[model samples]
Target: MNLLFKKKDTTMKTIFLLLLILIALNIQLTNAQPTSKYHAKLVALDNVYEGDVDLNLYGQNPSLVKMEWTEISPDSTKKTIHRVQYDMEAVLSFIIDKDTFYVKNLVDDEEKVRPYYLVRKVYGNDIVALYQYTSKEGVKRIYIGLPRRDPYYVQHPFFTDGTNMYTAFVYFKDCDALYQKMKAEQDGYWFKKGATDEQCVSIWKRIIDEYMNCKK
Candidate 1:
């Protein structure tokens, strides 16, 4: 009877220890992952964009592209002006692939008529994409603040594949978190020179992996 009692106590202790270890691991995992709000945002965004047309096709053929910048006057007013020229025919040809495109809020001709293909251009190692938002003053603003080098290196807060509507929206939504991860993993600095397609894609794949893992 004494031996059986001792064995029962030992088994109970072992089970208790295992439960404690499992609890600790759950806490660690919860702390390591992103906040509940971010996860909720991801879920909401994924659902919103799931069935939309894949804009990747537009980026595949970027024949005509243009760059733009923001100009703030002394009066504290801001305006986005075209920094480079564009070919209307080239822009039109690209858009002709799809019947039509629309923006949620058509504030101006720029955002209304302009297709993603014309506004987001990829150079050797850099991507310049138009970012538009409604300002506090109730005006639509646009700008392309691209880095001279591989924007990914500096954790540029824009998508490298902005021409892809879904991907770009996801990048814009999670840019800060993604940038922090990239900066921490890549020696905490941005690349000083242009990056090749292979290089950029490899880095992006890692970023995507990290994101998906966290989601899991």
Candidate 2:
């Protein structure tokens, strides 16, 4: 009986060892995939918001824009990982965090923060459009009240600059579905369920401006 029990224990250990090895291999394989170049971020921004955002019209927050991360494929391939958010009902205000910066060279006036979300547009029938800033790992995305600027007003626009808020003949319009698919793929490709974060934000600004005028 003792000899038979010992043999069973040895078999179980062997099976456990094999399972571990297989798991490791699967993880490696998952991390080895590559991604295609996605220009959807530019398309959405240009098509929807146009040049209505930013002080200089590049559509970026004119304040502190800390470098964030870019997404990587499971196989360590670089991914675009374009992101979008919708806060049709969220507030829009400035971020005023005191003591956000520590002392530098014994300066008397400590550094202050004044983060804010400039207006941006959403470009998909799936995800709602937002004027919020791109989110990083730990930083907070603060919103304040500004209902007049909400894109949800597409049905009854109260403002316009060009071919923007016109009812072609007579109808309310919103973002298209094709743009939704493109945006989805871009957002999901780099957002691994449990992987990298802010470190992946590409430092290059041109990357987000390529398709600034593409159709949905």
Judging by TM-score against the true structure, name the best candidate.
1
What lDDT does the true structure give each of the candidates? Answer: 0.35, 0.29
Report RMSD for candidate 1.
Answer: 23.1
Give the poorly placed runs of model 1, Cα more than 4 Å off: 1-180, 185-192
Clashing residue pair totals per candidate (backbone < 3 A)? 1, 20
TM-score of each: 0.23, 0.18
Off by over 4 Å in 2: 35-216
C-alpha displacement of 89 in model 1, angstroms? 20
